[model samples]
Target: MTTSKITAEDVAAGVAELVPDAAPVEVVRPLRQGRSHASWVLESSRGWLVGKVLLGPAGTAGLERLAEHRRLWQHGIAVPPVLAFTESCASVADRPLTVFEYVPGVDAEEALPALEPAVVLEVMRATGTALAALHQVPVEGFDDAASGLGTISATWNTVVTSRVEALRDAYRFVDDIPAALVKTGLDLLDSLAEEVSPVARPAVAHLDVYLPNILLDDEGRFRVLLDLEHVRWVDPAMDFVKPAMWMFPDQQSWAEAFADGYRAAGPWPACWSERMAVATGLELLTGVKYWTQVADHAMREDYLRRLRAWVRSDGADHVWSAISSAT
Candidate 1:
């Protein structure tokens, strides 16, 4: 079933329908602007809350994210308590919408000023620990529904090629992007397809772990993690790149903190760090696709800065070289 377009009033109605007794007093956009879904701040007599209305039809992907959110919360990870989920095809807005207990906090993007080297290390470690914990979650009879090891191996090619075509379409109208970079990036993605996929061991992971998705409370502690839209049972290595990209920004020092954190939390297979180079390269190639295709002008510019930083990073060349060598 396809999710219908959502409006502010539709969101209000959904909230009222789900929690029939509660009255929504006001609605405001809490997030600056995101491409995935519309996020908002909802105020009610009971308390403040945030709501996310999926952009397109509610599909298995959305359901997966919700399920993962619930699962992680039950596992003691910091995340907003899910208050209500409204799903019905007959509703004015057909897409499923969820309202969450508004965890009072600031996104790491906004809180970056308060982040110092020490705090960055701590947060990086915490993120590594949290990711390790997430990867340990079990799937019951539904294991067949999740992608298999072969599927994971194929995703690198499928997602990259599809996104590259989108990039070509997007840039077909714009002239400023360098053709050489496009070709080189595409070649890199093509080369990545031949590298060995990680061992078939599967675990749950929040594949989308951008800094904006990580929140910190007023007390300077991690309050909650948001946006599990990319949740899936995949290789544990799938979760590492985004955190590294965010904390290290190409500086490999952050990897040490992450390693320390991951090890401190529990036993990670000894090969985890060994796989970082290839895993991170795939993640970077994905970023290239996103920046060249789907991202808005401002977002594209921001990503370019990060990309250049990565390219100039000390060990980044070594990472990319390893991936190339493997191919």
Candidate 2:
């Protein structure tokens, strides 16, 4: 079935098939669509639940996400529990549909701005603690493509190089991005590729740790971490990319609070500055492409501006600087 044709009744029917014992879905409220998936909040006879439909080409990503969620849940992380899933439900055609227990809290992104400064910092600190716990989870191997939840089987430098090349190739086809900005981005990525070294060990990294994925309780404590589809086995420092780009650039105190909390758990990694810088640069390049494709000109332009500033400022250590000052 086409996405537009999907309705609350259709989703309720699909859920019944996957979870035979589930309570009848009483109400279905659509949530904002993510880059790769569409989600809905469901009120059922049992309780509240969430239904997600994988809309992207990543065929096995739903399975991979389920595995990641279970793994995190096993480690005592605050992730929503998967209730049921089907690879091809009649409601969504060939797309994957998964249901999870609904997390009851407000998204940190929307809630933080209205909160007091100290409260915001406290939330950031808690977020850092959670992320530190996430990076401590053991990963068995570099790549496990057979399970569709794999990291690349290459040295860290090689991974950076490959990502840079992929971004370069992607940027070539875009017409609006300035030629000079592209050169700066490519040159900075090349430099970063040479600077990074192999990580001591692979860890479970939630590469998308921005505010929207973070849910906070009324007390300003982190309640649930959502959207595990981008989970990967990579250098723990790589996880800082999203926050560094989206969270810390303007709010140094929040960055410091987060870094302090992370350091409280363990020694911060060596060469963290360079590693996070590289990760942020890669994200900026990828973000530009993503926003452009989605026809979000404001977001696309914002990414372009950040990319130019970051590359021109000698891989500006703003994120690292804030993090380091907390030490």
Candidate 3:
């Protein structure tokens, strides 16, 4: 909801300072503003590019995210390479600014709904394969910036528990969350947390993997991945959480196809079902809390509806279950 204070002049100055060679900025058109950052499509003498200005508290984490993007690119993930980054660009809204190579494509969120079912299946399968490659990149500690338990944790258990505890703590003050739902959520978290064993080894996970983060071309083929800011080292199953929750719950065949593609590339661990269930439950709880905090009643109500359904089913009505049944 925070509007960007960045102006065309600011963007031009940023381009001149950070990417002097790409100067003589011809166009600076604002793109959709995200929750934590404001972005613009920039056309310059060099070529087209995307510039992002970190907003609010997200400014401090720019360097760390830049490094993560570089790591993913080095490992062959289709993330756009960072061209230039600055921690403090006083002329550019006095916030951290990063410019990246502009990838030409539409986000799958906008493209998927219009595609033929068969093509949609192929896209989902390709997405599954792409995620497999992403998770193969080995990583050490878990870094969840939003956890508020610190930037990095030694174990995935710590991160997961911290998130559950945070939700439980919020239950006291968030009057919007139903008491019965909260109780069920807490109990489910405790039970599911126990069911999910520790991951053998951490791999890179795009913690936010919903349709909006996936890019596709004119022909509906996967082009590039977007939004590497939330990438972390965690259970590979965690990568499936968002898509499982938001992307494929109603699309059972898509889930099965994704599972097929994933199986072709790597081992589909037996624990995947439990892991996805618990992670999705926790994510729903977080979504309820977030929407309530932002006072978005419509979204809060939607999240509550989904959470209630999840609770009614005892967390079994999830994409993983759908995929398991079909497989």
Candidate 4:
């Protein structure tokens, strides 16, 4: 499908600027479901390339994402190395674009749900192994910013607290969410965050580490973890909980497979189960406000329903029990 606001000509021009004698752009197929960038797959005389276009008010992590991918690659993680990148795209409203050699596969999200339950667990087990490998890259702070005089929180605890406070401060306008429910969830996360603080330190984490970003080959093997922009230096438990809550919520097999994968890769931090419970609560509490702001008004009922059941049902303890067995 043709991508809107971008065209074959746009891609050709973008490529020509970098490689004057490069093959003419032949195929340009749009890639959708992206929340941030307008992206495409371009086939040119040169070869196949995946192109990402960023055209908006400048955000912080664009360049850092590319850098972090290389960092992960250097640390023994398999990631697609950027072939060509440019932050200047004056031809299309000052959009910035990066071209990478494409890594092909069906999205794990689309692939896993169709398979048998045991097969799904195996794929996620592999995904968890990959995640643990990436998490082995140590980070110094809560964000992608280089740890510096003013760029980092004094303690990991401060980072966690500051995040909740920031959410509490800014998400006040999300009236669609029940205030009592939000408060209860946040309070749970706050307590959990504190309980885990005694052992917190910076570890590489992908905040949105879930099946959607994972690419799976035809044989049910893990291909690659696609997006790297939300990569952070936080508790590895954050990475653990992210998948549990999003990809296969309350699915014991999913949790079991993931924990086994983590163990398969190597030993992880101690007390991971408890830390993950805290992380789950944090993600659940903040996700209401976060997703509410990001999603359309039509999604209100869905988010509310899922969140309400979880918050009202002793969600954290139940979640911990379901997943902790895997450890």
Candidate 5:
């Protein structure tokens, strides 16, 4: 459920248990950290790899992720091949762990601004190509058991309503939730849920597609997509919301290049772009509670500002203006 507090001794011992006589075991913290799992680099005769310790019990999510990793690899996505997966462990501080090949490439976060402009373009193009292939995967089933398989929702709207309610409930634990904010969120969720047309089954998407998760080669070409913990079968539009709302707003040319590469590999539905835009607005509004309550107070204002800006975005601008006037 969170990143573990792991030590070199624990990892070394865990590695030994996973593979007898697996030495000389060396564990080092990675330069970049993940949100839910503490990642470490493991160096041994077997090969250089990364080990992740899930802070909480693995249960269904951990096992399901291993299966999904295999499936993604089978589909030829540029993801790290998972080497070892285990839920229970006596040697690794009694936590669940997954080990995979340590990508030998530069992280996009490190290479983006410091590198030449051409390099960033290369990264975008490669990322687009991989995303195209990833989206090609057919929707096997619906609903998220976290692994993208479990109950099926006939309509995405049904799922949206449920999620909005869940987010609202989660805000109860927030330190100080103003009544007006809750009312505004509930109203937006109601209106947005009504606006979406019925959609086909969900698609396999990398729920988190930020630049940090993407790795680039020395030339700034995307090589691997990492951090595959929460990937699931969800709204196809969910995948592009980040790029459309965040990435595109920052770099117009880079976003266009990525878009061109994606379109070249396969056919995009005429409405896919519109769906993504709507999803962006909906996601922004829904996430406001989490940002304000769960996140650090320092980030609260900036997060709320982004959400307010989203109100002025494509499909949301007019609705938000009316709400503003009414209030």
Candidate 6:
């Protein structure tokens, strides 16, 4: 679908017209900082706020994001509030846009490394608890139709049997990977249908739970989890694996501490290790595919680097093994 390019000026004007009491301050562009959507920093007399506009007039997903923001907020998750959203195409560019009140805090990724290990572990524990709370909220209106996972899974299954062979034939790197490794990876993918079945839950997940989406207060508290665009009702495991995205580099101690803190908030699922393994493997594959699809010079390099790392790393294998053991 074609995305409507709505300018900041258009967003400012729309917000002013809609919320008369809201004094317009300034609209700052959030360029290249985010993926899948364009966002801006807006300052009003009310305070600093963040506003986002879908890339094109195609706003099918934007509406869902707006609703998710409201839902999470109502459920006591700290997220930017939606000041206004419209599909009326009132912008000078006639593009669909949604504006939100921006919350102030640094993303967790930027801040996590500077903190002491103990502090980082605590924050991660808080993050796990927060996610548990989010999952507890009963979501309505969003069904499986609300996800990209089904289509993603179908596409992956079809390609798993052939894409590896095709890529090997097309690229020199293909030969760099051992045939045994390829067969093992392919076996995991082929059995994805059965192995991934047990952990599936129809609960609302934060979807993308990387450090960037988490925000921290000055005291190192988990202030707010942001970015609900990818939020959906899916496996709870999807939200649980986020701390590993950044905290994994810290040490095993952190993971264990986080696990303790998470269990303090709620019960861990039976066979949790296996569930995380499958989710982590899928996460790696998703990251690799994202780079491949971007079709840009930098993206290609990034993709190849990650693909290389996945080939060498045993993390994905650990995930697969955990799942296999569970069955």
TM-scores for all candidates: the values are 0.69, 0.87, 0.87, 0.83, 0.84, 0.71
- Per-model C-alpha RMSD: 6.2, 3.0, 2.9, 3.8, 5.1, 6.2
Task: Give the TM-score comparing model 6 with the true structure, all chains together.
Answer: 0.71
Q: lDDT of all predictions, in order shown? A: 0.59, 0.74, 0.74, 0.67, 0.66, 0.58
lDDT of 3 by residue, 73-192 (tens): 888877787888888777675677888888888889889879999998888888888888887776666666253213767766666677777778877888756888877876886677
- In the range 1-327, model 5's lDDT, one tens digit per residue, is 113456766766676677654567787656466656777788877788777777777777668767777689878899998877789777666788776777788778777888888777767777877887887887655464233455567666666666667666766766665556555655665566556646434667776776888988776778888777767666666766665544555576677677667777765544554455456655665556656655666556654565565444534442112211112
Output the number of the TM-score-best candidate.
3
Question: Any runs in candidate 5 off by more than 4 Å, and if so which?
Answer: 1-5, 19-24, 145-148, 312-314, 317-327
Two-way TM-score contest, 2 vs 3, winner? 3
TM-score of 1: 0.69
Residues 250-313 of candidate 6 have per-residue lDDT tens digits of: 3666566656665777667655655555455444444444454555556545434543454465
Residues 192-295, candidate 2, lDDT per residue (tens digit)? 75777554346777778889999998777788778888777766776877787788877788888988878877667777667677766766777887788778
Superposed by TM-score, candidate 2 places the C-alpha of residue 80 at a distance from the truth, in angstroms, of 1.2
Worst 10 residues of 3 by lDDT: 141-150
Model 6 root mean square deviation, Cα atoms: 6.2
**Model 4, CA-based lDDT:** 0.67
User: How well does candidate 5 match the true structure in TM-score terms?
Assistant: 0.84
Error of 5 at 92 (Å): 2.8
Instruction: Select the stronger candidate by lDDT from 1 and 3.
Output: 3
